[model samples]
Target: MNEYSLLVLATQYSFTAAFAAMAAGTLYFMMERNNLTPEYSPVASLCAMVSLVAAINYFVMKDTVGLDGQAASLAGFATDYRYIDWLITTPLLLAVLPVLLGRSRMNNGMMARLLAVDVLMIVVGYIGEVSINRAGGGTMTGWWCLLISMACWFYILYVLFAEIGRALEGADSYLKSSLGFLRTYLVISWVVYPLGYLIAVLDLSDNLLIGREMVYCIADVIAKVGFGMAAVSVAKRLSAMQWEARS
Candidate 1:
């Protein structure tokens, strides 16, 4: 890569690292604010922390990874992506499981159904990723993974928006705030992955040259930052609400 390309990569890494730190902090605060009963808090926090750690590791090691060829250091990228997916989605599934199983008293049938759908979507995503990795030619299987990821993202956004609407209906400030943050975060964060896939699929590198790699890096950074911000915003909102109720 040229000097400009190298600079772009460095910038991207910095952005991603910053976001990872923010995510970790956000999750820590969330656990404390929500009073997430030891059982759920640890898992949720683990999700955020793992994501943060993976991002940082990727950022640090990005320079060492080759991205010039078809067989470029894909293993490192795949490993990081897998870690992120597992961390982010697994805890979310855990949180939703209770609602789906009818163990929670919150009693929103629609939300429960949405959670179930989210779980299914995540499952599909994992399968798609596995298929892509095994196929290795980045053809049908890669497209399938990209498509499934987009589908799942849209559904998740729908769920967040629906929750926010419901919270508004009840005038529940905390829930509304939480949902709003989630909506913003999801929308922004999810954009990166799709964009990266699009760039790859379209073969935009022909025109952009090494700049294309920078695009992927930038996308990763944006997504991580959005996630971190959303987590922190939700945690703060919940904490304030709890304090208000107590007073």
Candidate 2:
């Protein structure tokens, strides 16, 4: 009926979903590490790492789910742990791009720059979110941090698409094709974060909180587990090709 109730329900569901992601990630990592090639271990492990991070976040946020006004205010209305999760996991997710594309193609300098920007995006975004709780000039600081974070995000996308274009152009057919889907997936899946950010910050309605948690839960599953599978697919294809050439 109200936003609080909705958020309470959403939070319960999120716990289940987050746990599932972590379990799936664990299974994936074990299978890949034992059965798949060494090249895929990093991808599998990173996937597991992000899923585990999400799991931790859901646990951290459990305390604030359905409290009333005074209780909620005392408990802190926002879940800063989500941003901390993002800070750790996002760069790991992005690292997949270079791993798949080959470092020479992505280049060490560009990769470092991308990671730095990614860190900035999460850190600034967290600062912005927390600043909303401050008194006096807090609102303005929050907006500024958010704006800077968004700029950093857009810049990262620019590097992924515009700068990486040349490298993709020269990639083999399999890599080109697989990476095409990956690029599209990254763009689409990432759009969910800003929407989550808006909802989480504005606290527009209880439904918005519900929407935010659900979106984040679904997005994590897709971004981490789904993308990990994609990397595995590419690695498998490459392995198969190598075998064929040798045979």
Candidate 3:
């Protein structure tokens, strides 16, 4: 347990809050445009609010929860259990979101790709959780989680980028304009996790005190900021497409 570790946990929690807020906003916007139905919008909003609440809880209870320790910390608990729980449940919920919200006229290929990616991410997340739990060593388990997470994230990023490109092919002005920013945001934001994992693998933290901090920072940024950006992007695209049909 140390001050640095506490700081790391606090940072992680803050990032989660930021992500949840963004997700809630995205879902709300999509609902307004009829991209997502009212029923599903409430669910998405609830999840987002939960994420923020969990983040706050972690931050507020950090010290009492042994968050300064390497093996037992608030951030560790969230990543090792809570976040994994969400990852597993989210895909199942999402599998039904499209059905409940009804389908858009957008490319089926893109939707299929996203669905596939979500499934893969859930599977990979489970694998990561299992691997880390089994490894049972600080650096060892962390490395295992980092590797699996990076792999899954990279795959997700690829799918998202490819789908956006496909959508841009003959997209209208509004859709294209929105996607241009979305693409850049996704590519850059998603890089944070992998970069952090790479740093961990290289064992560069020995020379750089900031290395450990970077690892937690990247994880938080990717999970929160990256996911938020994605939710917003998808919501925007779907909403705009619906509007185009009406007009």
Candidate 4:
């Protein structure tokens, strides 16, 4: 089969797999929700919501690839389903990090600002994707949207590192370390999306395009399910921090 067909199959199956993973994550988190103390209860719910949203999107995306006649075009991103998925899910995933710290460490203002920036980042990145993917550029052209989105991304990281990390100053080492790892992993996974968009801009070979879609699907699974599971583990640890003393 040709590259377009190959890309569709590869991504379709990948989305199916992510769908299963996310569904499992949602069930797992919901089952564990009631087991946690009130302080950590929202952790499970937040995680479940993330997984559920991702699962639904993956299902829709895979179907779109196979049935909605997804096609590659120099004029526009073929897999814009992924963008729609990211628009909703990215903010929820971002919320996982701060929510783990509870309201005390991440106040309402901070959480709102962080999520707002995340929305801006994704929205602008989508704009960049559409602009650059167009046959001869959409409204804007070439890297402006990409650069602005990158700046927003960097701002979010600044908040995570400088502001949120400050809030984490007195947290247990285990919790802090776990959060650090989760944040890094999620950020790195997120990098794949923009890189794929860049590849589209380069007008790379179909092989590269196929590879990009496959990679994007795999990374989506990791980004969604991995974050939820890791967040659950960290939340439980923090919830039980007082177990020894109380016992």
Best by lDDT: 4
TM-score ranking, high to low: 4, 2, 1, 3
Q: Could you estimate the TM-score for every candidate?
A: 0.59, 0.84, 0.53, 0.86
Preferred candidate (TM-score higher): 1 or 3:
1
Clashes of each: 0, 1, 0, 2
Give the C-alpha miss distance for residue 54 in model 2, angstroms.
2.7
Q: What's model 2's lDDT at 146? A: 72
The residue pairs that clash in candidate 4, if any, are: 75-134, 75-135
lDDT by candidate, in order shown: 0.50, 0.70, 0.47, 0.75
User: Candidate 4 residues 200-242, lDDT tens each?
Assistant: 6667776677677778878887888887788888888777875
Residue-wise lDDT of candidate 2 within 54-74, one digit each (tens)? 666765664555334222332
The C-alpha local distance difference test score for the whole of candidate 3 amounts to: 0.47
Native-to-model Cα distance after best TM-score fit, residue 168 in candidate 1, in Å = 4.9
When 3 and 4 are scored with lDDT, the better candidate is 4
Candidate 3 backbone clash number: 0
> Could you give candidate 1's per-residue lDDT for residues 131-165 as a string of tens digits?
54465435576677668767776776765565535
The candidate with the higher lDDT, 2 or 4, is: 4
Query: Which pairs in model 2 have colliding backbones?
Result: 3-206
Best by TM-score: 4
